[model samples]
Target: MSKMLTYDACVERIEQLREKMIVTAAQKGMHDPLVLQYSQELDRAHNYILFLQSLNIDNLSKT
Candidate 1:
């Protein structure tokens, strides 16, 4: 079985994915649907980061 990824690893992967998406979109001169989809995904990643930060805050309060 595969081990679960740490939070830092997940964030790093998301960053790499975002970078790849940006580069590909720019290279292909993509517009409309593809661009919109990537932008939405990037936004979702940002939201995930915010959620993680909130969890950190909760952890700090418990300590």
Candidate 2:
């Protein structure tokens, strides 16, 4: 089975994407399509992080 990403990993992905998005925006302009794509990816990463946090909360409540 494939291993699931930990919360820390998701946060790390967000950080990486944030850096990349900034660099892309700087090089290609804020309105560039690639920059928009990176922003969308960042949004997905943030949402995943929230989902992970919710799972943790559920687990803690169950314990």
Indicate which candidate wins on lDDT: 2
lDDT (Cα, tens digit) per residue for candidate 1, span 1-63: 033445686588678768867887887766756766777766766667777788889999999
Pairs with backbone N, CA or C atoms under 3 Å apart (clashes), candidate 2: none
Candidate 1 C-alpha error for residue 42, in Å: 1.4
Looking at model 1, the pairs that clash are none
Residues 1-40, candidate 2, lDDT per residue (tens digit)?
0346788887888899899999999999999999998899
Measured against the true structure, the TM-scores of the candidates, in listed sequence, are 0.66, 0.88
lDDT of 2 at 52: 81
lDDT of each: 0.71, 0.87
Provide the global lDDT of candidate 1 against the true structure.
Answer: 0.71
Q: What TM-score does candidate 1 get on C-alpha atoms?
A: 0.66
Give residue 27's error in model 1 in angstroms: 2.0
Could you say which candidate leads in TM-score?
2
Which stretches of candidate 2 lie above 4 Å from their native place?
A: 1-3
